[model samples]
Target chain A: MKSNLELVNDCDQFPPNRDPSFLYRFMVNGFDCPFGYLLEATVNTFSWPDYWEINHDGKTVKLLGSSLEERNKQIHDTLLAERERGSFKILKGWTSEIFSVYGPQKDLVLSIPRIAAPLFGIVTYGVQLLAYQSDTSDGAIRIWIARRAKTKRTYPSMLDSTVGGSLPTGETPFECLIRESAEEASFPEELTRTKAKACGTVNYVCRTDERGGGELGLFTPEVQFTYEMELPKDVIPTPGDNEAEEITLMRVEQIKSALGKGEFTPANGCIVLDFFIRHGIINFENEKDYIEISSRLHRTHAFPTA
Target chain B: MKSNLELVNDCDQFPPNRDPSFLYRFMVNGFDCPFGYLLEATVNTFSWPDYWEINHDGKTVKLLGSSLEERNKQIHDTLLAERERGSFKILKGWTSEIFSVYGPQKDLVLSIPRIAAPLFGIVTYGVQLLAYQSDTSDGAIRIWIARRAKTKRTYPSMLDSTVGGSLPTGETPFECLIRESAEEASFPEELTRTKAKACGTVNYVCRTDERGGGELGLFTPEVQFTYEMELPKDVIPTPGDNEAEEITLMRVEQIKSALGKGEFTPANGCIVLDFFIRHGIINFENEKDYIEISSRLHRTHAFPTA
Candidate 1:
């Protein structure tokens, strides 16, 4: 009964996801529309086109499919023009953060965390893009874990943004992604050039209190845009500057092995890695073999099966 | 037979390839060093391993099947170990202007070209990174080009490098690339994460001044390096403030078409596009074919096949 944009505007609006603490910029609509214009009440939560199903809440759920939908929306017509080509849907979403507003609006300025700060303090949302597979050779999905700088201020030495940075201010999640990738790698800024398209968004209430009280322990909710970046064999994980220390390529066997060890850290890297390995990006040579990295985290959400 | 670096230094160099006129920097070694640098060189030139040829000078040359013996003499096992696994092989050379000061260092001071400036003249050289192809889809050779700014004080809007630039004082061409990509794209400084690997060298001369008033035209020589960057599809091409007016994605098909229509403009862009297209890094199906911009002049060089 209502448009997706209308529904997006209904949800709590953040300039880049509305949280000042987070450092990323993202755009909402085709024409660079303002934040909060798309009410959350009108749009559906989101869903992976292929594996979407009903939840206990009995409402359609979407996650990691926002970018996917957005991608499809852009090239749907052109792709359909080529009958032989298979279609990939792109989903869009606003991954926002709410920073506490204090002091006078006139003199007060916005800021982002030192670790997440963009060249400039800009906040935004991104559209998650993804691709699906049925029987890939790897069997297990591949999770790309970005090894953080050992000396990082937050989430130090943990994997973050396999999909990339948070949304940038005054830009859409997609735009934020273009910026993120540039900052992250020597990659060309053409987002749609390769198979690295938007897949969808994963809606989850992520709370990070790894620091205990105050300072780094602040709690905040986040909507993550999952993007699909297909790494060719030659593309080894080489991190850029302090943003990433190294990129640990993960496979499912390692995930299972780590979970068995029972030493789970609060860092979300393992969880995300588990998702990738289960989804078939990473290959498991032997059902019994595993990598040497930690894998003790519990799987909060297992990949959907057909 | 001089050492590879010496041979590279002895070969024609693009003196104009730098800032502050007369300062020259461009050389490439044809040998594989230990340290796995071969792959890095290969990746730098050709976007894919399949697009490369060991005996690049002949029809028998093939990628993925080069024997160690077939590699250039400069390539030794020790050097090979230093190379990365997926790099490209580039061809570098110098211009005749560099030779003018050859016998001994002539007191030379050149200014680097500036936009509105009392043009800063710098000794600039022409370095071309080569991306090899089999001959056609099954076997033809090709290269890439960048449409230059026509109003440029030196080269103007001619198609210069598929991706190239002059070296500033004290900076290597590889470093120049880091500066170039950022300058061209308005990209963040972090994007220049990867280094450009030295491929090989080319020796040739260009006739500059057609006036023939005893003030002979500037003779050109060059040295090019091949750099590989696995860019995300979303990266945009924003061109530098002084270099390009706009960036256009052209394919070999378009180049062939243009060549057919008696419209051979700068062929470098199409040449590089052909390399990437063959490697599966770029797809013409997703990009718009070349559209008519304006009539521009282009040059074709015929060097003995190396």
Candidate 2:
């Protein structure tokens, strides 16, 4: 058995870890503070109440205590005082913390870093479509697919769902999906709860063109919550030009096949597909073409376990 | 189930949370760069990163980003690039985070928050001492009760295992326990792997403090790890002033009875004692005096059920 340090260090030694363009860079960092938005920060090492003075542009902020006792004491006192006074402070301040709009922020691929500080950051949430092609000639399950405009800052020329965004501060998993759906695809709020299929959070991290030492921008750990909104046979994806350029209705198999073939670099969408396949949202096993193309797109290999 | 907004708005409605006067308070507010020194500061809820902007002079440092995402992204990018380049850039500045140290600066209370952060900050790990008064009157199995100090912040003036800290950042469960033991009791390193017992993480939140709101610091989410240390009859607890002030030996029955009577304040320890009694670490049934006293201490109800 390896020491925790050894194991973490070894995992860190893996090369793909250093890749700045890696889509899931931040996932390696553990834990997160789920505020309205996800936060990725490092819990400072050392006992609490332990202070380290950092010199910024000058004015000194005394970094103070670390002991849990001290913290709990303050809380206890504050609560007690508030109880006696029958009044407590309501915290409110507009922070200059950096936040990014995901799902085609610019004309290029965009993503948030997974870890920073100690325990805070952002995560991406996306809806995964699972509409399949009906055998009936006139039976085509209308599925919405939004395309990334070439001018996007990150993940340029990629495909993604209509409703997706970086989770907002203090938004729950379900709320984020609903908000993204309305913003990106203009999906009706009614459809949010009706057809809203919460797949799961796909944990990943990535960097953006906004470079700082090429250092990873610690965003909230992203977990794309895939929601399936089954559309009428004629309903189509009408992506807002500001966020997306094209709306295409392809057979779910085609999307899967393209993804498997590595034809589309939908960084976050791949995991959503995993959810779809795992949850039987889209069945491809029986479709020979879909399976073949998928194998070609995503060359998955399974090794026998002895 | 209530909505998230409702939950957040109603958070204050719940008996106020315990922030306590631990060193982490200073760090939590924005003490940049950590070093070894106890800091003293007040606990206040600032929007996540906003706390970083707070100056020691009580002036808010101007933050670079306007939102959490922006701030986190910038920090993440910088860290990653630095890591990739194998050079850590000193964030050029200081956030006046304060903390205070009590007792021996060596190893006082195990820095559990640092450890718990990595473990999702939602889990608990604890150990229980099963002490007994064996038939060997000539030579009793001297149970080394790793005594906790009274004045040491957080659960000050209470009893805790000498070797218990929350799992630290980048530490495994066993590693945390081992580190706690070595730091607190100066237990041999080898003993970490040897006779040291792991009681496992307790999955619960404790609002056991009764400080009311006078201090604004009381609640603590703890994951306790209990260990049974067999002390040589001659070796009594000679606690260092910082972590533990004294080591008092209570008969097994005293502890069990204390637990039964709910006399113990930081109820987590009481639970551990009960576990110890049940496991024979402490023979409550046999040690009538211990039971009598401990029962007096058992002031609260049984382990709270939600």
Candidate 3:
């Protein structure tokens, strides 16, 4: 019997892949290092350090550094100079505000500026915690969301997760969660350490705006480990620093609508949506892209293992 | 204040990234296609068509064709010839047993033998319906899984979803479900059409074995549109054809163990695990990789939009 096999080439062929934005590359020296992303334009920028060279064929760029010391020194000094020249600005609300640098198989232990993390397309690790509470005995859930201070740089005035901070090197996600919870929202160290649930991670790749004289700014590959804390009805979230302007409680539907209208930071929206899926606020029957959305929340390729 | 920006350069500094196992290429007229995947060896002991040429680059191969029509004709005729020689056999109970041939954009509408799908990394699409029931008045749930006949080819005698069939070129997923349920499980078309709930879709990519010597086989990229049908407590499923040996009802825990022990077909196991998540049997609290598993079920890269 003849079967009607479908003829499908899912990766867009004609108009090119709608997203040619993110490419994976390793900076090579003594070993292959998972360096951050670089724009096609940035790769072609001339006057690279004498010890380093780049090879790219439209898709990916391999940064060939002369040595680990040469590479680290070149990147650190050059990137800092660029930032001082107003080429990059810090995302002040991001926690820990440290960068994760890696050498093949081990932590390089050299953290760059948080704002410069994306310029190199390095996988910037961070922690995000969502604190929720049920006011009534009926178990109706309410979420606590923070608003970034307008005075802060990068996505200022945008809605954010309840508590989040950059994952500094030499720190585990759970440790960062406890620290950020206490510092960002003034959560008791004990409550955050005990009640927080490890939800999941969100991975995304995107291009930075034209930062250096129209040079292809680096592509940013980001990975954030997420957590959720169900607080009692009496718990209140208070901002400890300028990382947040204010913390407010929001209903699930309100958060959903705001996310739909794109009011929250891109990453927070993803983390919140994941909470909805796990909490049973959203399911397959109600959403057509339920499976698709759920999958996007995890950065499967971001981490090597737990 | 000194921020903790730990320095880490993660990757091989001297050596290039290992495991460069797959490559992507497009087949143009008289030129080699930069398609993805490099097999360890050519499929079976058979002579390839004279018009077709394959260039090897370590692991990745470039499939060059004299023309678009030439490439299509060579693959189509060659695969069919091998199947006729008993090289590739039809997988019974598969609705659309046709392989889809694609290069760049636009479907050539050229369908190949279904058995050759995975070898070429072809993204295959199909429909699967999970017919379940809640017998007790206490809102307890039980699932229906089918066992394939021992004599069938491919994963024979393994457990599978309640109702599943390949998605042919012209048929919509809903329509395929209605037809497959009737033909495979003897379900009334009306009940399937009316009672079933559209869950979502699952996407996956897997490599297949070679068919012709040293030729590029199929790389199976599969997308299955899934549905859930909650049947009446007393309804009994009978096999309409020999595709299934028998249908058995299973509890959630039993199915989990079977999945863990690898008793079910790989695809079926994924579908059922998705069922458990939506049904609240498996969740973030119980499953550490809940988000990861849920996301892996959907081919995030497969869909252009969320």
Highest TM-score scorer: 3
Model 2 stretches with alpha carbons more than 4 Å out: A1-142, A205-220, A261-266, A279-306, B1-306
Overall local distance difference test of candidate 3? 0.60
Q: In every candidate, what fraction of the native interface contacts is reproduced?
A: 0.00, 0.00, 0.14
Model 3 chain B poorest 10 in a row by lDDT: B3-12
Predicted candidate 2, C-alpha RMSD: 25.2
Query: What is the two-chain DockQ of model 3?
Result: 0.12
Q: Model 3: how far is A195 from its true place, Å?
A: 4.5
Model with the higher TM-score, candidate 1 or 2: 2
DockQ of all models, two decimals each? 0.01, 0.01, 0.12
Cα misplacement distance, residue A107 of candidate 2 (Å) = 36
By TM-score, is 2 or 3 better?
A: 3
Return the number of clashes found in candidate 2.
183
What digit string (tens of lDDT, one per residue) describes model 1 on residues A244-294? 676556565554454344222222433343234323222122211111110
Chain A in model 1: its TM-score? 0.43
Top lDDT hit: 3
Model 2 per-residue lDDT tens digits across residues A1-306: 322212222212221113222222221111121121111222221122323332233312222323434433432343344334533111121132323322211121122222121122233333344332234366534345667777775566666665556544345546666666666666677766566544322333333223222223333223344445556555445664467777677665676665554444334344434434333343222322222111111211010000
After TM-score superposition, the amount by which residue B292's alpha carbon in candidate 2 deviates from its true location, in angstroms, is 43
Cα-based lDDT for every prediction: 0.32, 0.36, 0.60
In angstroms, give how far residue B27 of model 1 lies from its true place: 81
